[model samples]
Target chain A: MLDQAQPMDEHLGFEALYCAHSDAIYRFCLRLCGNPTLAEDLTQEVFVGALQGFHRLKNRSSAKTWLYRVALYRVRAHRSRHESRNVSLEGAAEPRSVSADAQYAMRLDLSQALATLSPAQREAFLLVKCQGLTCSEAASVLRIPVGTVKFRVHRAVNSLQSVLSDTPEASHEM
Target chain B: MRCSSVQRRLSTWANESHRPQEEHRVQVHLDSCEACRQYQSKVTRLDYLASEFKPVTLERDLLPNIERDGVRKGSGYVPRVFFARHWVAIGAAAVMILGATMSTRRGGAYSASAQEAVRGMESTELDRTAYHQSLWQAAGPHQEGQLELLDQVWYEAGKWREKSIPSFGGDRIFEFDKSSGLVRLSRDWRGKIISQEETSPRPKQIDLQEFCKQAGIEGAEANAEDLGTRTLNGVSVREISIPTYNLQRTLVWLIPGTNLPVRMERQNEQHGSWTTSWLFTIEYAKSWPPSIFDSSTLESTTGGPTARASQPFHDAESGTTNESRLSQRSKLPNRNQPAFRTGNIVFAAYLSTTKPGPIDSACASERVAAQLRRPLDSLASEYGTLQSYGSDSHDTDKDRAAGSKDQVYNLRFGNHPVRSVMSFTLGSDGVWKATSLKVASSATP
Candidate 1:
C-alpha cells in the first residue's frame, strides 16, 4: 500500500507509484503483447494515461490494480488501431538466463500451448500463476468477480493440461 | 475429493489460503491416487515453466521514456505531442508513404542503373500493403508437369490468414491476428469446420524480405541481374534474376506500374541448366471482405455453408461487434461512387503531377474545373503527388451537408502542407462530379 500522506496527483507521489509498479506493469504488458518494443511503448502509454487521470484514483492502496486496468485498456486500443498479426516468442530476443537448447524448446512449446487458451482464461491464468497475483487481486484488476477469476484459471489449467498431454515429452524435454 | 476437484484446488492452492480441513482432504486424495499425483506433478511443471518462460527483466527504464513524453514525475501535464510523435518515431518504416515508381528494366548486365530498380523494389510497402498470394509447386515438363497448390494466404494490415491444402487431412485455415496476439487454426472439410484451435500467434514467412534472404544464395542482392519485362497472365511484369554461388536461382516478377511484386520463382541448377522448383504468386487488394479473416464466419466459395450461423466469433477486446465492424466498413466511401471515383482520379492526377485528361474534364463543370486547376498545378509542382488521402471530418457542418445537391467534403491528403475542402454535385449522367476545390487556407496542424 502507498503512503496516503503523499497525494498521487503531485509529481513526487506519482514518481513513487511509478518506481514501485513500473516493472510489474512492464512485465505484464510484455506477456500480453509479445513484443518488447511494443510492450515498452504500451507501458509508457499506460503511465501517461494513468498520470492524466490520477485524480480518479480514489484509493491509493489499489494503485497497482488500477494501473493494470489502464494497461489492458491501452493494449486493446493499440490492437484495434494497428491490426497487428502474430508476434511469437520465437521472434523475441533469447532470455539470458536460459542456456540449454531443450529448455528453450520447452519454453517455446509452452508459449504455443498458452495460445490455445481463450483470451479471458489466458489473462486470468497469467495474473494468478505467472504474475503472482491472488485471485481476488486479479479480479479487482479485471473488474470481474473472484469466483470468475478462479473458474477461468481452472479452465485455463485444464486446457493447458490437455494441450501439453498431446506432447508429453515437452515437459520432460529439459 | 475426486481427481477433478483436487486438481482445481491444486491449481489455485498457491493463490488461496484454504481451511486446514479442506487442505488435509486434498492431500489425502493426492496420496491415494496416482492420476491425481501425476496431475499435480504436471501442474507443478507448468507453474515452473510459466514462471521461467520469458522471465522478463526491464531492458531500459520506461520511467524516462514516459517522462520524456510529458508525464513528468511530480507534474500532471501531458503535452499534445503525445502518442503521434512517439508512435511515428518507432514505426516510421511501417507508416512511410512512398511514391516509388519502377525504372526502365535494362537487359543483360547488372549496372548502376539497375540499382534504381532494386531500390524501388526494396522501398515497396509489401509488408504494410494488403495482398493475397497463392503458393504453388510446379513439376518439370518431362515429369508430366502440373502446378500443385500448397497454400493460399490473405494478408491485411499485420494480420495473416493462410489456408494450407494438405493431402492427408482436410484444408486448414491458420489465422494470425497480431493485434490480439492470437493464432486460430481451423480444419475445414467441404466447407464445414471439423475442428478449430486458437493458439498464441507465431509469425510465418509472410514477408518478401525474409523470403528473399531464405531463397537467395548469400549476397544475392549484390549480384542481381535484371532480366527486363515479361508478360504473365496478360499483365506486363519486370523480372529480376539473382543467381547464387551454389547454382541456385531466384527470379522475382514485379508489376511495372505499382512496383509491387507479383511472383517469385526459385530454381535449381540441375543437369547444368535451371529448373523451376516453386513459385509464389501475389495479388494486391484495395479491400477484402470482412469475413475473410475469420474462418468461423467465412462464406465458403465451394457452395457449402462454412459459417456456423449459431455462433459468430466475437473479439471481446475490440469493444466493437462483428456486425458493427462490418457496418462501419460499409459506411466507408464506396469505391464505385462517382464522387469518390472522381476524388481518386484527381488524387491520382495530383500524384503523377499530370493534368487531367478528357475523362476528368467530363466529370466537372467549367467553373469547378477552372477552380481546381491552379491549386492542383501549384500543389503538384511544390509537393509532388500526395502519397495518401482520407476523408477528414474536422468540419462536421460540412459533412452534415453531404447527400445534398452540393456535397462538401474536407478531404485530407497525407504528406501534404494543407487540408483542402472539396465540393461535388450530381452530374447529368447520374454520377457525383467535383464542382470546386478550396485550398491554401486549410494549413495542416
Candidate 2:
C-alpha cells in the first residue's frame, strides 16, 4: 500500500518537489492536453498555483493529488477560455518525427482514439489507466464520485477499443 | 449473471476492482459464454494498449520560470465560486474591448520602428550551428533570492541543447534531439551527475518568432514604443517598452543591425508597486566545440566530488556535547527575553520604529502579513519544515513619537534549512502595529 502521508514532506523544498513530481505532472498534463506546448503551459500554471496557495494546503500529505486537482482546474480553465476558438483535439495530435515502427503506430492510434473520448471520460481513463491512479484517487483529483470515475473509465476503454478496431491498419492484436 | 451484466462486470474484473464473488461469477460467465469472453479479451487488450501509451516530456524544466515570475494573475487564489460566477463574462468582454482597441490603434513612429526590427529578426536566418548564452536576474525589492540562473544553449538543425546553472541551486543540462523527439535532462550536484531522465519525443522547438507572437508583439497588439538607442557591451541597441495587460510591461533592447534582443525586462504592477520582475541578457556565439555537446565527454570532464555519506540532522544534534550546547544557548543575546534575534537588527529596528501615519494599521498589518506569507507559502509547497521559536518583546523609545508607547517582538520563523527573523511592533492599545521581516542567508551566518 502506498503511504497516504508521504506527498508533502515538511523537509522538502520547492526544488526538491519539482525534482520529484514534475515529470509525473508533466506526463499527466501531456496525456490530457495532447498538445505538448499546451501541456507544458498547463503544467507550469499548476506549479504557479501551487506556489500561491501553498500556505492554504490543509492536508500536506495529499500534495500529489492536490497538484493533479490544480492541473485539472487549469486544463478546464484553458479549455473554456479557448472553447470559442474551435480548437480540435485531433488537430492537436500532429505527427511527430518518430521511427515508423509497429509500437509507434499503435501509440499513434491510441493517441487518436484518446482524442475522440469525451473530456470527462478521457480524464478519468488517463488517471486510472494511463497514470495508474486508483478510482478513489481519480475521483479526488477530478472532484467526481468513485462510481462516476469507474463508469467514465469503462466508457473510455470501450470507445478506444472500438476506434482502434475500426482503423484501416488495425493489424495490432487489439 | 446475464450477458449484459457480465459484459459490464468484465471491465471491472479486467481493472481488478471486482470482489472475489464477482470475479468468480465473471470467470464462470466467461467460461460459459462466448460473447462475454470476446468482450473480456477486448477490454484486456484495451487495458494493455492504454498502459503502453507513453507521455511526452517537456523540452525544458519550467520550475525556474515559475520561481522567477512568481504567480500570474488568473492562477492566484480567487474564490472559485466568485470566479465561476463573474470571470467568464468579464474576461470575454475585456478581451473583445482590448482586441477592438488594439486593432484600431494607428502605429506610431516608435511602433513602426519596433515592427521593422521584429521583421528583421524574424527574417534573419539563424546559423545552423550556433551557441547562445543568457543571464537572467530579477530586479526589485523582492529579488528571487537563490533563483538567478545562467543558460548556455548550443543549437543545430533538429537538435537543441542547454545547460542552466543557478547561482545558489543545482545545475541542469537539457538536450532535445528533434529526430528522436527525446529530451534528456542531466541534473548535476557538486560537479557530479546526480541523476538523468530521458523523456518521450517532444517535436516542438522553441522558436523566437513563437515567443514574440506569444508576447503579443508580433502583429496583434503592437504597443511597443522605441526609446532611441543605448550602448550595451559596446553595441548600439534600440530600447522599446511594450505595454501589456494588467499594467505589465515588456522592455526589450534590440540590436538594430542584427535585430536580435540583447536584453529583455518584464515589469509588473504588483500590490500598487511596479517592479522589474524579470531581466534577461543574451549573448551569441558563432559556434561551440563539438565535444561540448557529447554526453560522455561532458560527464568525464565534470568529475564527481569525493563522496561523503550524509548524516541525519537528529544524529548530529544528539552527538553535540550538552555543555557546548548549553554554552551556545547562553551566548545568545536576549536569551531571557521573548523577542526574536534576527540577522539584520538594523533593518528590523528601522522598520519597527518607522510609523505609517496615514496608512491604516489594520490594512498595513494585512499587507505585511501577506508579504511575509509569500516566501513561507512557497516553502510550504516544497514541503519545507517550519520551526517557530517563541516570540520576545522589547520596549521602544517613547520620546521619539507622541503616540502611545510600543513594544516590539522579534519572532524566529524558519522553514528548516532556511530561516527568517521578523520584528513586529504593537502599540499600547494592541491595535496599531508594524512588521518587518528578512530571510536569513548563509552570508548572515
Candidate 3:
C-alpha cells in the first residue's frame, strides 16, 4: 500500500520499498523493453541504482515516480549497448482459457501495430495506458512536459487506430 | 468543441483529467461525430490488446540478491543489524533432535580455530572431488510423511548427475561426464521411463571456484563462528555457524583433521521456530567409475527399462501411465465436488471473488471458501478475474496418519507478481482443502 504521499522514514526498510513498487516498476520496464527477461534485469538495475541514491531522494512523495525515471534511464542505456537486438512483443504465452484463434490473431495484429509506433509515442502510450500512470506522472517519468505527453499519447492512439483498423478481424469486429 | 480538439483531448482522456465543462463539450461533439467515436473504439481496443502482455513473475525473490549487490556496491544506506550474538550455543539435545550434530557438553572440546577450519574449507581442492547435495524439508516428514527430497545433485570434476522431481519436470535424471562430453537425460512418469535422449554440446561446467562463489564460501568465512565438535554418524567433525542477515543461519560441518566441510545446512526462523530449509551433504573422492555417468545407470536406479520400446508411453493415450496427460482431461470443474485438478480450484476461488462464476457453492471446504472470500475482502476496490495462475512446480505427499493428501501449487497473482504458493490437502472423504498459503516473495522496503 505504498502511495506517493508515504514519507521516507526510518521504519521504511529497503525490503518494504521494493515490495510496494516492484510490480509497477517491473511492468513499466516490460512495456519499455517488450521482453520479460530484459525487463527483470532492468528492474533489478533500477532498484540497485535507487538503493545507492536513496538518501538523496528529498522529495519522498514522488518516490514511485522517481523510480520510473531511473528505470527509463537504465532501459535507454541498455538499448544503446545492445543495439543489434530488436524489441519484440511476440512470443507471449496466451492464456489457456482464451479463444486460441482470436487471441492469437489479436496478439499478432497488436504486435505489428505497436512495432510501428515511434519510441517516444510508445513510451507515452504505455505509461498512460498500459502502466496506468497519469499523464502528469508519466510526463515526470519521461522528463517531459504534461502537454508533450498528451500530444505523444494522442498521436500514438491515432496511429494504432489506423493500423489496427486495417486488419480483417478488426474490421469484422468493429 | 471542434472534432480535431476533441480528439486531442480524447487521447489524454484515459487519465480522466478533463474538466466537467470540457468533458460535456467533448461528449456533445462525439455524439454528433461518427469518426471520433470510431477512433475512440479503436483506441480502446488497442489498449485492451496491449494490456494482454504482463511482465513475467520472477522465479525467485530478488531482495536477498539485491541486498547482497547493494552491500557489494557499498551504498550509503546502512543495513540494520542481523544477529545479536556472534556465537550462540543452543542445547545439544535440541540440535541433535533437529538433526544438527553439536557438542553435548556445556563447552565441549573442539580442535582448530574457526578461521583455520574455514581456510581449510576454502583451500580444499575440488578438482577431483566428488560432491553430492540434497534438499530436504525438516518438519515436513515429522509433521505428516517422510522427508521430501526437493533436489539432488552429484558432481565430480567435469562429471555431473542430477535427479529432480520438480513440479514442471515430473521426474527427471540428467548426467554428464567430461570424457563423453554428452548430456544423458531420462524423464520418468509414474515409475516408468517416458523418454531418454543424448543431447550434445554438454551442459555448462561448474568449476570449484564458481561453486564456492555461488555458495558464498568467502562470506561464510568472514562471519564464521565455531559451535564446537560432535560425532555425526561416527565421523569426528567440527561445526561452525554463520548468521546471515534477516534471521537466517548457515551451519557447516567439517572433518576434524582435514577441515573439509562434509555438510552445509541453511535454517530460517520465520515461523517462530528454527527449521532447516536446505541441507547439502558433500563427499570427496579421487574419482568415480564411468558406469556412474552412464545413462543405463540412471534407468537401472529409477527401476525403468533403458529402451523406450519396453514402455508404452503415448501422451494422448492415458491410463498407460502419463499423469500429465491424465490431469489434462479433467478440465470440467464440478461445483458440488472439488475439481480434483491441479490448478482449477485456485483459479475458481480467485474468480469467485471478482464476479459470479463456477465453484460458488462448490467452494464447500472452509479453507477454499476462506481463500475465495479473503481476496475479495482485502482487494475490495480492485477486482479482476484470475489472469494467469501457472503452477510451475507441484509436489504431492500422502499423510497416512491424518489420512489426507498434501499438495503444493505455485501461483502468480496477475499484475501484482506475488509468488503465492498455496498448499492443499485432501481428507479421507476425498475433499480437497487448502492447508496453508505461503508468500515466497514479500514486498521489500
Give model 1's TM-score versus the native structure: 0.35
For candidate 2, what is the DockQ? Answer: 0.12
Selected candidate, larger DockQ, 1 vs 3 = 3
Error (Å) of candidate 2 at residue B303 is 33
Which tens-of-lDDT digit does each residue in B298-387 have in candidate 1?
212221011111123243323443334222211111222332221111111100101110012111223433334444434543543232
- What would the per-residue lDDT of candidate 2 be over residues B202-274, giving only the tens digit for each residue? 1123233433552323331355677798888687878877664334666777767545555655565433545
If candidate 3 were superposed on the true structure by all CA atoms, what would the RMSD be? 20.6
True-structure RMSD for candidate 2: 27.0
Global lDDT scores for all candidate models = 0.45, 0.43, 0.44
Q: DockQ for each of the predicted structures, in order? A: 0.13, 0.12, 0.18
Residue pair clashes in candidate 2 = A10-B383, A10-B384, A10-B385, A13-B382, B181-B201, B338-B391, B338-B392, B339-B392, B339-B393, B340-B410
Pairs that collide, model 1 = A11-B73, A11-B74, A84-B178, A84-B179, A85-B178, A115-B199, A115-B200
Residue B385's lDDT within candidate 3 is 18
Candidate 1 residue spans exceeding 4 A from truth: A1-12, A55-58, A83-108, A165-174, B70-445
For each candidate in turn, the TM-score is 0.35, 0.37, 0.38
B257 Cα displacement, candidate 3 (Å): 66
Candidates 1 and 3, the one with greater TM-score: 3
